[model samples]
Structures are given as structure tokens and as C-alpha cells.
Target: MVVPKHGVFTTRENKVYQMKKLLVSAIPALALSIAVGTAQAGETLDAVKAKGFVQCGVSTGLPGFSVADDKGNWGGLDVDVCKAVAAALFGDAGKVKFSPLTAKERFTALQSGEIDMLSRNTTWTLTRDSNLGLNFAGVNYYDGQGFMVSKKLGVKSAMELSGASVCIQAGTTTELNLADYFRANKMEYEPITYDTSDETVKGFEAGRCDVLTSDQSQLYALRIKLSDPNGAMVLPEVISKEPLGPVVRQGDDDWFNIVRWSLNAMLNAEELGVSSKNVDEMKGSSDPNIRRLLGLEGIKGEGLGLADEWAYNIVKQVGNYGEAFERNVGSGSPLKISRGLNALWNNGGIQYAPPIR
Candidate 1:
């Protein structure tokens, strides 16, 4: 893919171009607005309500996470999160417009009010949470970094990748993890960095690099884009922890709570055996937790400035967390990824959430 210009930025020589600072400097009023947290704090929810749609930030094209089709239709796990939020607020799942963003542009876009929330596959780290003035709602996908290489190379493991040139995208945790992994193993490899994920995969496909490294989930998505999908194998080694999720600017307690609970609604739905196919029926059940969750027994959404049936709208329109996973990246999708670490807490994984009550 081509690297975006101007409004978007890229990394070079290990230096991240601060588009946020530059853009803020260009508009003094905007800089001041940001300084006082007026850019995205308390205004987000009201702004979204006034606009009648949520402007969600997403990756340019990462299949099963966020990708647009040839006809401009968007789907994937991240896209569904945006839809879930819209469903909660407007009672309409389609009330959203997506802005495709690069890794370098995602943060600036959110900080500058270019997008309502960032549901792109971003890692939650201390540096980002504390320094960027952003808050991670919760982990939607638990992932780890791994390597991918063409089967022709005959490399069975990452340890055998010494001296190999690797293709990796810029402005991501994978870059630093690659260096650390090689240094820890006392191995040396040439790093070929690109501005976008598509560019990184294309470089690998064109033989500019001998291997590609990223989150294993991304490896699966990228492999499918290759000319010979079956020719590449993802290494079994997971190098670093990557808790990927949606992010909202810090200080918007109301907005943050809404987004956070939208996701938790889906998780709780799955845990409660609620699915879109049966949500309407489940709403009539006598279970107190399910009753509160579906707005039948409590004013659960009052504190979030939403209708009591907010979660019901999400489940009825967008399905639960497990439903989104199964269709986007699990058994029903091309990736067919197992819910290894993403399963519900009672079902062998740690995806737990607080009760709506």
C-alpha cells in the first residue's frame, strides 16, 4: 500500500514524526483546546449525539480486524466495536462512518477530533496509556508477536532466522520486539521497515525481506493477502505480550464509560448465553443479571447517559463478543483462529467483565 501523505505521517530512521504536535501548532486554538482537554473530553458524547453518527478510527486494511471491501463496505472485529457503540447510542448499528488511519495517524486523529474513538488493533502499554493521554477501555483481543516466513526458506523456528532480512511495519510494538528478540538470542537480522501493513507484506511478497514479523493474528491476516497464501508459515514462538483493544481520549468519563461498557455488554452477553439470534427471547427470561443487562430490571445505562436498553440494542443489532469473534476471525472467517486466549472466563479463557448491576 502507498504511504499516506500530509494529514498522515510515517516513521523513519526509528523516529516517529509527531503529527499531533505539528497539527496542533498549525492551529493555535486547537492546541489550547487540547491543553485544557476540551478537544475530546466531555464533548465527545454530545458531539456524537449531535452528529447522529460515530466517527470511528480504524486501520486502512487489516482483514478480520478492520478492512474495507471493493465496494467500500467495512467489517471485522474493530468495525463491529464501532457498530456496537452506535447501537448503544442511536439504537442503530449502521449509524457510523469509518476513517481509515495509519499507525502514525491513529493517535493524532483521535486527539485532534478527527475520529470519535479508535478501535484499531492498537496495543495497550504503559507508555501509551500514561504519556499519550489515552485510556484503553479493555482488552478485546489478547495477542502476542511472532514471525512468518516462506516455506521455501525451510526455517522451522525463529531461532533459525539469523542473518535473515525481516519486513516489519513502522510505528508499532513489533519493531522494538523484533530487535529485542534477536538481541536476546544473540542473533543478527536486517530489518526492513515500511510505512503501512500492506507495504510491509508487499515487501515480503516481493522478496525484499526473507521474513515478516508481527502479532501472530496479523500474520494470519497478512498471509492470506500473499500470492501464495499456503507458502508462508507463522512461527510458533510468541515473543511479547500484546493486549489489543479500543481507545478513547482520557478525561471523558461519560464517553469512556459508554465505550467501555459497550464492549463489556458484548462480553457479558456471551457469558450469559445471549446471542443476537436469541436476544429478544432472552430478554424475557427471569434471571436478574440477564434482566438488568437487557434493561428489564434496572436502570443500568443511566449513569452512562444512555437508554436503559442500551446493551440490548448492542446485542440485538451487533451480536455479542463471541459472535463477533467467531464470524470475523474465528471458525467462520478465513483466518479460522481459535479462541485460545479470548474465550469467556467460565469457558477456559480470561475474558471476564463486571456485572451490569
Candidate 2:
């Protein structure tokens, strides 16, 4: 046996002792981590159930996505997503509240648990999904970055805006996309950053920037807010792929499933031709796909910890995805955006969802 100094041991004995000490010191931290993970897994759903509503985070005032009216009634595609989740959980779409958040405040609001889910037309990226400790439930809107300039500017193409001043919302992926796009094209421009889409549009209208650059859908939404909508035109150059969607914090599979399937229910309902106008009748559908989606049979919602009528409630109260899209941002609304890429997969677009079963 190797001799040791006072209060010491052999080398191998000391290594073992040190490892034991390290493990002993790490036990509490490991235990706490597990406890926290467990707490987070089901906590959001339990709290939402206890409170009787979902607190959804949304954009401050982005038209067609999550804007509020004169009487503070929130309506838009993103708002409909919140209502859909509420309807799925509580069987009542009205049992939800909206928190108007800026681009900068959105992720933090969700991370801090101030909101159960974020439906703020946020883009999903590798960094956001992995680094922010959040998971994007799914893509609700397939978008792309584009430029909008005053008709008087005679700018028919983004290539012409090389030396222009661009108004962009701060704390968004658009900034990075704009930089990459301009750099790749050997173009140079001055950027005027604002905190919100509203402020960004205001900056553009105030002549602080020569052009407003944002998601193509948002460009259309903002153009209508202009004093003279016809005075501006969106350029045809699409610079980046922006898949906008609802986001939920990581570590809560139950809550994640609820939010994801809520959107999925809307999408599947639309694909199956089950709208709010015909959901009740569709419940008696002979087609297994329709019957399963309406929770008439197969799986029947128990897998998601929801009642069999969960999907029915979502469709009846919030309508299908197609209805929400048309009412908020498509041809039925002021934006009048064509369902080019947002159309269903069977309809020559990419909006496809898994079956409820």
C-alpha cells in the first residue's frame, strides 16, 4: 500500500475519494434538475386548467396576424390560433387572453412563463428552436422576406434599392436575412431599426427610410395601413424563407402536443372539408378520416389528454385553418394575399398535417 501524508491517501484512493466528493456535490444539482424538468412537463397545462384560460403572447398590433379592434377585441390569424388552443382545452374558444408583445419581448415572455404559448407570427429558425429553449409547434404561415417601396420611387426590383435606407423591425430574423441578402448581392444600404412593426411602418411613412422590408405577408398588411395604400408596391424579390408559427417552451411535451394538435386539428379539418358550418354534421361522417378527426372514433383525444369533442370544439368555435386564413389574411380580408404557398398540399401548396389517429 502506498503511504500518504497526513490527511491524505494513496493516489488511487484519493482519485476515488475525489470522484465520490464530486458526485456528492453534484447530487443536489442533479436532483433539482430532474425536479424542475418534471415540474415543467405538465405545469403549463395544469396551470392553464386551473386558471380556466390560456394566456397567449402575440404581436403588439400586426394586422391580419394578431391585431385588436376599437373595443379591444383581438382578431387575426395568430389570435385564432390562441382561440383554437383554448377551444381544444376548455371546449370554449373565448376562454383565452392575449398579451400584446413586441418582437423583442416575445421569446422572453414565453420563456418566463408569462404566456402559455406564443402565436405572434414568429419565424422558426435553427437558433430559435435550439438556443431559446423553445419548440415551434408547426408552421402556420410560409413567408419570405421582401421589400416595399413607394410607387414614386420607381423601384420595380429589390436590386434597385442598393443605396436605399431600409426600415426594419428590430430583434427579428429579418435583420439578419436583410444583411445576408444585401451582402450576397454586393448591395449596400442603411438600416433604420424600430422596436415594433407599427413603429417600423411609422418610420417608413415619416420618410426616415427609403423602403420598408419585412415578410411579404407583412408588407401587404402594412401597405394597407399606409395613408394611401395604392402609393406603395411590394417588390417581387423574395430574399429568405420564413416559416412563421406558434412556439412553446421546451420540456413540456404535453403542452406542446396540445398547441401543435390544436393547429393540426384546424388544418386537418380544413383538408377533410369540415368547417365550422358543417362540423356537427361531419361528426356523423362515414369516412373514417372525418370521423377520426371529429373524435367520433379512433384515438378519441385520450392520447392528448383531451375530451373526444376537443377537435369538434376547435372547429366549431374557431373554424378551420382555411377559414381563419381567409378571414384574417387571404382574399376575404383587406390584405387579399393569394394562397400561393399557404395552400394545402393537395391544392398545390404545402399546408399538410398528420391524421388525428
RMSD of each: 8.5, 6.7
Candidate 1 TM-score, C-alpha based? 0.89
Q: Write the per-residue lDDT of candidate 2 for residues 183-299, one digit (tens) a residue.
A: 999999999999888788889998899999999999999999999899889999999999999999887789999999999999999999999999888877799999998888899
Q: Tell me each candidate's TM-score.
A: 0.89, 0.89
Q: What is the per-residue lDDT of model 1 for residues 239-322, given as tens digits with 9 covering 90 to 100? A: 999999999987677889889999999999999999999999997899998999998877777888888889999999999999
Minimum summed lDDT over a 10-residue window in model 1 is located at: 6-15
lDDT (CA) for every model shown? 0.91, 0.91
lDDT of 2: 0.91
Q: Which residue pairs show backbone clashes in model 1?
A: none
User: Candidate 1: where are CA atoms >4 Å away?
Assistant: 1-42
